[model samples]
Target: MVLQLHVWGPAFALPSIDAQCLSAIAYCSIALPKDAWELIASSDPSVSPTGELPALQNGSTWVSRFRNIVDYLRQYSDGAWDLDRQLDESDRADNTAFASFVESRGQSLIDLSLYVTSHNYYNNTSPAYGNLLQWPNQWILPPKLHGAAKARTDHLGLSSLDLQAIEEHRQRDHSAAVAAGKIPKNLIQRPRETVSGLLGRGSSKNQFRMEALTADFFEPLEAMLGQKAYLLTLKEEDVPSSLDCIALGSLSLALVPELAFPWLRDAMRAKAPLLSAYTERLRRRCFGDSPVEVAHAYSPQSAPASPLPWRAPGRISIAAVGSTLLAELADSTPFLSEIRRNNRLKQAAADSDLTSVEKGAVSMFADSSKKDMYVSIAAAVGGVAALVGYMFHVGLISVASQEQEFEEEEEEGIPDFGNLSAGDILGL
Candidate 1:
């Protein structure tokens, strides 16, 4: 049976929007043959057993996340699919170290460039998600992702890059200035601070910070890749390793895509031209020239006798939508938020050793399933009540008017009992 790799849909000319999914796709592109596996742009995480993307399906079993998928594939083929198998002990150790570094630093940089910065997010990354997802999901997922990115980069202490926050601060200052009967300078300067002017607003400080962030991440990788075509390998013709795939995953998002800010990409090209070149070569080698078409080419009808490996955008089941809507609604309620927090604490206590991403998957399904059920039931009941109330309000469901009821009573009069005695009937 052909293994199926379900990942986030393609965007910005890349195989996947997410770094993890891109890494998984790159790994599969290198390790597996064309006929052995097929790519699916399933985008939705609810289809995954683990509530994560880059889920690998082999017949009835599914493996989630890029690292887990790699492990499973290695074990599946008894090391035949292991890209790191050829490395020495020392090289493997280096691989592990660099992978962690890339995940943390690289991910932070991506978050800053793509999500934390309001300009780039609103203009570029947000639209990218809109292109990838369906109606309700398009509305929901982008902000959720932006929130996640904000949470990840909160410790970076580079709030100056967050233009939205800066604007809010400016608004507060203006309000205070007006209240104190003082005219703020920005009030007069507002017309001059257009998109072009934003770059020059605090150019020195913001540019320095961005450059520092870029250098902190790229300098090490550039040093590692020096004079070699791939990281951890000396030969130009050697196959790219798992480390290469992982690095490419993050670097492609940073370097390949044309963002509104483009600081990271600019810095990468300027400072680390060698690594940039290496990333381009590897991306082409793994995904070929037309990566978008390669990623999204397979359709259900491509293999008539077998099951479809892909789910089209907006093609989710009604049940899935109902559950998602209920979850979103539940998340908005204070009581449910508290309940969710309590569940998270309890789950953390129970599974203290698991990594955050893996813990998220487990807790999402195991701890929150009952909560989701309860929320769904409550939402259904509330919806029914609302519908009935609306009908009553609109006169679709009405009781007789008091005057009409009185008139009907008078017309009917007191009911005469046929079985009553003759004297009683006559008196009545």
Candidate 2:
């Protein structure tokens, strides 16, 4: 209850617009509007010691970045509700790499859909933020957001860029992923980056290209899950990992029509349907049904003790009850398609040899090289620092000074916002 997290909210709207805030809440497992921690929404970033949305103020500790906030939780909090608490050393590395993937590629896609696209920006994101404010801000802030996003969109060359250009960008990302080296050798045997794989299932139309690029984000995620109850292997008592927290965080905004573009959601569903269902189970378990809005919440029920007092020889036991329950729920709901999808993804991943941890890399790319330059560089710096600290934590790196150097490097330079509005830039 000592943690007071500041997120974005509305005076007049439905679900929240700020995905970063949603990510923070998921990482912290605050149990939404029901939890003890205070969640406030203010347009002002001055209150943040580091001037970021979703800043944390807990006792004497202060944090403004997602990666740092995660580390703080690992250091200070109990493991009971900690999402990343259950991760093994290898899985911790996997979680870190995949979390980087989500923040870099996944976040770019969300930003484009929400604020840069003409229809979505004017129709959805702007009005949504406008609704969050009082009388003048209600009327005032949205246009500034639109102009800024439009300028950035133009600057990124989203419209003028072509397929060939996108593939080139993919090559660059592929190179970066190879250099990332964050994923360990036991969890992901990184897939071969063939031309077909790079372009994403072969298509010509821009929408096809867009769909393929978006689908790329889900490929590694689906493969990683295989057939587990959650993304990582966990016993009944184990909590989710940072991998799970981040996946939930990214999907929290993308899955909802109120918050994300319908096309983007459809693309994610089509690409990673199994992961979608897995996300549903995680969503229901962690956030509860209607966590963001209103619905009939279904909490998975625990099985009672066996009727017989004594243990019987060769007695039939329950067949994977926890996951089975979730599977049954999927079968009964409209998400039956996802149940069917599990087999397809499983087959594809098996054929590609992707479900293991031997290799590494994800080559998801859009049409412009400049498109991800800003966020990619930003994530790489923080991701490297985190990996170094993690290595020191697990004794993978022996030198204390090396960890200290990286921790100091983690205090990165302030980003240049270019033409973005203060509201748009600070809103994140």
Clashing pairs in 2: 83-240, 185-357, 185-358, 186-357, 187-356, 187-357, 188-356, 188-357
TM-score, each model?
0.75, 0.52
RMSD of 2: 26.9
Model 2 spans with C-alpha error above 4 angstroms: 10-15, 30-36, 59-61, 78-82, 135-157, 160-205, 234-237, 258-261, 291-428
Worst 10-residue lDDT window for candidate 2 reads: 294-303
* The candidate that achieves the highest lDDT relative to the unseen native structure: 1
User: Residues 1-428, candidate 2, lDDT per residue (tens digit)?
Assistant: 55666555521111236666656656665322334454455543334655456677787656765666666665665544456655678887887788789876676666666765545665677666654554344544566555554555454435322233345665677667667875443444444343334334443554565766587777888888877766776453556666676777677566655542366678778888888888777766654454342111011122122110111112112443343345446645533544344443443343332436422221122213223454666787899999988997998666677888777777555455787888897796
TM-score of 1: 0.75
Q: In lDDT terms, how accurate is model 1?
A: 0.79
Question: How does residue 364 of candidate 2 score in lDDT?
Answer: 21
